[model samples]
Target: MEISWLGHSCFQLRGKNVNLITDPFTPQQESAEPPATLSKINASIITISHNHPGHNYVQGVGGNPRVVRGPGEYEINEVLITGVASYHDDEHGKSHGRNTIYVIHMDDLVICHLGDLGHALKEEQLEAVADADVLLVPISGGKSVTATQAAEIISQVEPHVVIPMHYHPTPDEQRPAQLDKFFREMGVEAIEPQPKFTVTKNSLPATMQVVLLTPR
Candidate 1:
């Protein structure tokens, strides 16, 4: 499968038979980073984490995708997806509303997208995403989980590949630090960024590693 980050929490996971996108953000949203254009997005399935404008803009995509919202089990175009209910804030969505965590089975690999997840996983959530091959996590320190919290969560999940998202990559005066804070928490000074990530079930490593993708 090929995974491409389109800025913020949006990602396109492409397989041989199916293509899926996660949390398509609006262009005008504050979280939208440079080159975060939605006109180029085309997917067979689109997953919305919540009703927030930053994540629920389905019209931006052109492929007439089957949009999946909230918690449910769905099989679209041979891809199996399980959406687990989560929250946008740590206080059970009281502050930022509810979110959905999607675990997708594609190309014999289990890919988990933790949509705007604001807190550490509960026992049930952990069970839902157990043994994930690739984990898409929000590591920004603003509305989502902080860098330290994200590192702890990564430890608990122990996914084979962890991809950090929803960060301020552009030069924003308010939140200038991009992935630096998260990298610090992970005890890494630098990691070479890749344009996209491609992996197969056989290519997965035995141990966990962090991959920083340059949004395209």
Candidate 2:
């Protein structure tokens, strides 16, 4: 499988001839990269997790991709996409309804996208994410799970690789930085990539690890 961060909680995943883009943001949202500077994208499937602008700017994607809203299941190309229900708040107390976390799987890898997940998972939620080999998690707090909550979920899911996102890495004029807190709570060694990576089934590392990836 191949994955590329597109800043914030946005990421593009491609494998088995299918392309999946998750939680894309509009230009005005907090991002490490500028929207006008983004390369044109053509995804086979586009997923929006919730109604939040940062997670649901449907107009930003350059392609007329088959769009999927939160909380559903479908098959695109050879990948099985399951939308598991979650929340963007500790409970659904803050007028935010439900959020959807996507689990995508192919012959080689199982990838989970924690879409603005606002709270920790129950055992059932953990089981739902069990097949994920690479887990895409939110690192910032408030609207999503806290760093410690994310770490605990990672431990429960036991993904081979945990990729942290949704938090700023540098203290810029936009969002506040929170990657260090995420790393500390991870409680495990993490892989540092040079912004992008390519991997086949044979290239997957043996031991579990958390990785902090930046936008492409």
Candidate 3:
């Protein structure tokens, strides 16, 4: 599978048979950096984490893609998707509302997308996302989990590869940088950002590792 970070929490995943886009974000005027111009998005499926404008700009995405919103189990185009009910805030949606954690099974690899997860994992949530090959996590603490919380979740999930998202990498006038703090918690000094990432089941590392991808 090929994973391309579009910006913010948006990612375009291309598998053998289908193409999926997760959390497609529209740029906010007050934001420091603008999101990618999502045009000609030939996606077979689009999984939304919540109804927030930055994560739910389906109108901007091209192609008549099937959109999945809430929690459920679905199988489309030979891909098995399981949505686990989660909260966007520690108070169970009282603060930020509900968030959906999507686990996608494709090419014999499990890819989990934790959309704006505000708290640490519970026993049930951990079981639901067991044996994840690739984990897309949020470290911004901007309506999501903090760097310390993210590190704790990583220890619990034990995914083969963890990709940090939803955090600002550079100094932006509109947004505060969070990657530095997250990296400090993870004991990572620096990470070279790549444009995209491609991996298969056989290519997965035995131990957990963090991979940074530059928004395309």
Cα lDDT of model 3 by residue, 20-97, tens digit: 999988766665443445766778899999999889978667678889988999998899999999999999899999
Q: Each prediction's Cα lDDT score?
A: 0.87, 0.76, 0.87
Candidate 3 residue pairs in backbone clash: none
Q: List the residue pairs that clash in candidate 2.
A: none
Query: RMSD (Cα, Å) of candidate 1?
Result: 3.2
TM-score for each of the candidates: 0.92, 0.88, 0.92
For candidate 1, write residues 1-216 as lDDT tens digits. Answer: 999998889999999988898998777755434233677767899999888877888878878899999899999998999999988899999999898999999999999999999899999999999979999999876678888899998999889999999886665433336577888888876787798999999999887788988877
- For 1-216, candidate 2 gives per-residue lDDT tens digits of 678888888888867687778988778757645375243777778888887777777667766777888666788777788888888888663756788889987657888899988888877777888988889998788778888888888888888877888876554533244666676676544446446555566777788867656676
Global Cα RMSD, each model = 3.2, 3.4, 3.1
Point to the candidate with the largest lDDT: 3
Candidate 1 global lDDT:
0.87
Candidate 1 accuracy as TM-score: 0.92
The local distance difference test score of model 3 is 0.87
- 1 or 2, greater by lDDT: 1
